[model samples]
Target: MTATTIPTKTIYAGTGRRKASIARVRLIPGSGKLTINGLPGESYLQYSPNYIRITYGPLHTLGLDKEYDILVNAQGGGLTGQADAIRLGVARALCNVNPEHRGALKAEGHLTRDSRVKERRKYGLRKARKAPQFSKR
Candidate 1:
């Protein structure tokens, strides 16, 4: 008996992060290449390993068999934060692909947003939490 296979619905999503000033981005399967917000001559190869690892999470964990075009737009973060944020976004997109994976992705904490960010400084302080030097003798 010949068995028939069912087709899975493809889902498209976007993610972004801010680190210092640079933004990180990630997109789903595309035409054998990655695109980033229309910045010509830009390649995914230029990004760090973390960015690569997270952006390609669905490919590695869920398998790269998928073939779809994803566009990413990110800004206002350093490469590290951007990379992490991108991972968060991709993980989210994957969940969209198949809601069943939510448990696994959530267990891994990939779906959670990073709350750490730069804190604004207050008056009479050198930094956000730091205060002026005080000496009493």
Candidate 2:
């Protein structure tokens, strides 16, 4: 009988939300690589510099952009919201990797989750805040 051993390394996880989007992130020690929902980060993000930049904000601020691989499973909202959520998740995972990172990530504002979301449309209104043209008749 032969026994096989699997190498174990520390894995950090975090979850973030923005608008209707949610991102579950995992940080693994390796060359910088990003995979989202089984797709390459760049391809999934449509190679947008803005989005790519946003997702790497925390890592860049901490000078660890090339020190870890990011794997994210994101769902719901649009790409913008998903991008923001990923940023927050990455920041949080970094914190889990090292509590001391909280201070720096917080200072960079990457640890903050954007809480703004579309307001639910009211039953009596055409939209969340808009009502049918004022009938001043």
Q: What TM-score does candidate 1 reach?
A: 0.67
lDDT of 1 by residue, 1-137 (tens): 11122355334564545444333333444552445556421354365565666655654665543564445566655556656666676666666666887787777777777776789999899999998889897
What are the runs in model 1 whose C-alpha is more than 4 Å off? Answer: 1-11, 16-32, 39-47, 65-69
- Among all windows of 10 consecutive residues in model 1, the one with the lowest summed lDDT is 1-10
* Clash count list over all predictions: 5, 0
Every model's TM-score: 0.67, 0.92
lDDT, residue 119, candidate 1: 95
Model 2, C-alpha of 4: deviation from truth (Å)? 19
What lDDT score goes with residue 121 in model 1? Answer: 95
